[model samples]
Target: MLGAIIGDIVGSRFEFNNHRSKAFDLFTDNCRITDDTIMTLAVASAIMEAEEQLESAAEIGDNNREYYRLVEVLAVKTMQNLGRSYPNYGYGDRFAQWLSSDQPKPYNSFGNGAAMRISPAGFAAKTETEARILSEVITRVSHNHPEGLKGAEATVMAIYMARNGADKQAIRDRINGYFYTLDFTIDGIRDTYRFNETCQETVPQAITAFLESTSFEDAIRTAISVGGDSDTLAAITGAIAEAYYGIPENIKEKALTYLDTNLQAIYEAWQEFKKKRSMNITFRPAKLQEREILFREGYREWPKNRTFEEYCSDNAKEDEYGIRYIMAIDDEILSSVILLELKSIMGKKVYGIGSVLTPQNHTGKGYATTLLRKCLQQIENNDPLIFLYSDINPAFYQRLSFRILPLEFQKVKKSTCMVRCRDENWEALLKSSVALIPDYF
Candidate 1:
């Protein structure tokens, strides 16, 4: 249900992808969350309060609509709190002031803001009829335009239809009446959508993704394949998909790692809400990757070593796995040192954990640490175990909540040409095992 918000946070940076490839990341230390996240969380807070207020109102037999109105008030207030708390979380200039104080102005700005942030309320509604109604009411607080209302209403309704197990066409037919005129079905979307933006274009496009899928993950991939705002589209789609398909145990499990303690708590609250609705299936009992496959692709046989020029030339190859990583650029040159995603030595399926580096003069300003958290959040999988080679200073890792593992424990039971591959003396070499997590980054 919250997958929509997660999508926005993960996709915030690539809204206008330019020429970069999706293969570029998961980790590195650059990508960051944006206002879509701020606003979505704002809505979630409002929904939680709405639920509480609704129960309170029901006890007194107050009008049913009053409960949703309470939610609208809380939503505006929560959005305002986010502005004051994290002004730099990337709220656009015009909206930032609205988030700062009580005196407010709801924007006529018909951006996807309404659609992206409204998923939470949609899923929170008790029924399809109720979902559409709340969509209209909640949206009026900010996005009151016809198209804006349509976009937000469309997303919430899709999530409602999906959770109830309505088929793709059934859901499509329901919303198509309100938005665009299209005999064009979800299948048409699968066949036609190549790439586009704007809520008018992407919202319906993302809706088809949910309409066409069987699993939450599939819905995400479907949206990603068409491109556009991959994260946002996937997010908007994923929220609905989660309602229909539920998060696969695999994705939800892995997504857990990316969440810091605070995010984790929020996720748990979301789960509690879902449990009240229906049983959800997910990818549980996470799988382990093949060891042989690891030996082949990992650092062992350093891929036909290529210089920077050669590496840059193979853009497609970079997207495949380890080739593309974040870089700090300054003026016309590459600034700061790079954080390499060298092969990971962590538990099976834990993937890679490399260095956390800041470009040259970017040191004391906290850019590297900020980047590390952002990048880590991007790729934090749910394998439950992640290990990394400490950047020379073990102290750095220690600060990030990592405890030093004894070097003797990591050594391979077998040796290479009579030499131990895992250095028994590794602990003597540097600092702690994991790095400290910075406060807000």
Candidate 2:
């Protein structure tokens, strides 16, 4: 959601001027939020309202048909309400007309607006099927054209897969199989691409921009460099990029400033709504029946030339050190981490977190992050120090307030060692402690 807003603001100045190069400054005074941001927020608002209403309806009776019907109705109402509030936000001719119509109906449009505003559905949905259902419900209120529906569904699915930890190849393959045949590259088409507003022309290029990008900023730059419906292109690309590579804190902070009071409130409310939803997630030690699945998954990370039974036996031995903590909903394990107790150093209790893994099917739902946060809350007050050897990007743990320890404090050969301290004098504590490296998990 913020990703789309950031892209919309950054690309607003270039939408008409067409700066077909990546060397331009990202944010400027001329940059402004447009229809993209408005509709994105509107869609998000409608979804939240619909979900709240659905919960209420579920308490009374089972009415899936009526619940979805309400979603479509609220989508139209919210978009019109917000669109009318921002009358001069550069909405397209047909969309502007639809907004003003008291009895607005689908205009059979296949515009890029459908794809640009569809990202919130991806984030709100729990499964690919729900993602498609949400996309179709919200989009059909305005962009009922088949191509428009396809474009929106494709974008939503890309976000769903990216958030779920699908690799680039998997996303590309799925898009190719169902949505668009991404045979062209950003570099191949940059010189020839022109201003276009249709979804068929816009979505594939935006997706390619994200595919070729190495960072969130790079995705925005690459989308603008294509020189076609710049804001919409970048908004589409930015949504996917944010799902894959989180927006840096600096970028997210700057982007929020562009929103006015009402929009800012909506964004804040959405954050709170999401947080409340995640509160239902529970974390605990892995159950006896679940250890085998954990072992099988862990073996993929560290096979050690051992048979399945040998790997299970070896993992069982680690129970003396620590137990596996799992994040789950109902009976499904979403993510797991090994919590190891290490020998106390300098009279401070030390704990090691390792084998942080989310099953491939559940990568992007933020289960691991929630699990880690729960783990920290469970231990931080009781222990003075906590440590982890990160096998993946250290930035992930950094976001959780872990600092990379100096090389002298590292015990492993190639892994990055990081620590979280409950005390303010942890640096001095580290420097004064004896040269005793703790055992690696």
Candidate 3:
């Protein structure tokens, strides 16, 4: 949804006059947030209101279909209200007439407006079926035509696929199989394309622009360069681009400046709702019941000559001190790290970092980095010397200021003992036989 808004603002200046090339400044003084952005936020606000109603109705045992019906009514009402609030914004003539009328009705038009404001449906739904349902409910209020519905549904499905880790080829193939033919390229259509408002003429070209692009900004550039219905085209492309390649922070900051206070407030509220929905991943110490889970993570980190149960039972004793930390999203553990306290050797207790493990599927998302930072903070008061043996991903720990110890101090020549501390005795501690250094990365 934010992607749609950003794209609308960036492409607003070139909506009527076409830009033939992809080389143009994204946000400019001539740029403005158009009806697409206003309507998108209106839909998002309606969804948020509907979610609140669903929560209240769920307590009274209302059926799910009843909740959807309420959402449909609220969506229409919200769009009408927001449309009235911004009278002079760039709305289509028919849409402007509908907005001012006491009886605003679906116009059975196959315009691209349906595709521009349907991103929230994709982001909020948990499944493809739910996405289709939400798309129909939201789109039918204004665009009742089949092409309009198809355009909105396709946009939602593309975002759903991209958000769930689908690649570009997979997205293109699925979209092609489900809806229109996407075999055409942006370059093939860029030169000859003209101002087009119909969903059939605009949505597929916008998607093709995304399919041919390298980054989020490039996708928006490609969409605008096609020249027809630039704001809406870039909006459709931006929605998909946001799901696949996240908007850079600087770009997001600049885009938000174009919106007024009311729209920005709605955007902020929607952001908070998204944050609430994504509150699954958390950090905490391992409980006694999860001892086996923690140990299994450790076993994957160090697959030595021992059964899984044996390794778990051996490490279960660490529960007494409660030093085992795991980063779990829901019931599944994604990463684990341990902070083991050593005995007072030279009148000061030392700490050993161990088992910095991240599962294969959950790598490259910073799970291990988050766990390591938390472990360090948990022991920051002691100012203890943190030591670890990292055979894999040594550069990660090195970036966090862990220095490699001498080769003679290591248990194996290939293995490395790394230390991190404010104290000077870390090097001396690494030389001791009780080092029990790390052997896995």
Ranking by lDDT: 2, 3, 1
Candidate 1's displacement at residue 286, Å, is: 36
Model 3: per-residue lDDT, tens digit, 1-441?
Answer: 889988898899999888989899998899999999988988898878988876752221122577568768988889889999998888889888877888879999789999998999888764455677889989998899999999999999888767755556557766787789987877887888889899889889988888888999999998899998999999999999998889999999999998878888999999998887557977887666776766665687776788887787666655544387888878788788777876555555567787677778676555676577667766655656667877776777764557777676666655677877653566556556644444332
Q: Can you write out model 2's per-residue Cα lDDT over 1-441, one digit (the tens) per residue?
A: 788888899999999889888999998899899999999999989878987876752221122557567778999999999999999999999999999999999999999999999999888776555688888989998899999999999999899877765546557867887899999998899889999999999999999999999999999999999997999999999999998898999999999999999999989988887786666567789998999898888898878689988988878877778988998877788999888888776787888888898998777655676577667656665545778888768988764657788777777776888877744546655776435555666
**What clash count goes with each model?**
17, 2, 1
Task: Name the candidate, 1 or 2, with the larger TM-score value.
Answer: 2
Lowest lDDT 10-mer window, candidate 3? 55-64
Q: Which one wins on TM-score?
A: 2
> What value does the lDDT take at residue 270 in candidate 1?
65
RMSD of each: 23.1, 12.6, 13.5
* Superposed model 3: Cα runs more than 4 Å off: 56-63, 281-441
- lDDT string, candidate 1, 1-441, tens digits: 457755654555556662133244432244455666656766777777667655642221123657667777887887787557667866656667667646876777555677878877666664445677777777877677788788888888777666544545546666776675545444445445554545787788778767666666667656665556666676788788877667666556554555556555665776675565333322111112322222233322233386544533442342344322333332211111122233333332333334233334333433333344334444433322334444246555433334455444333222110101123223322343422211110
Better of 1 and 3 by lDDT: 3
Task: Give the poorly placed runs of model 1, Cα more than 4 Å off.
Answer: 18-32, 54-63, 182-197, 274-441
Clashes of 2: 2
Query: How would you order the candidates by TM-score, starting with the best?
Result: 2, 3, 1
The pairs that clash in candidate 3 are 389-438
TM-score of each: 0.55, 0.68, 0.66
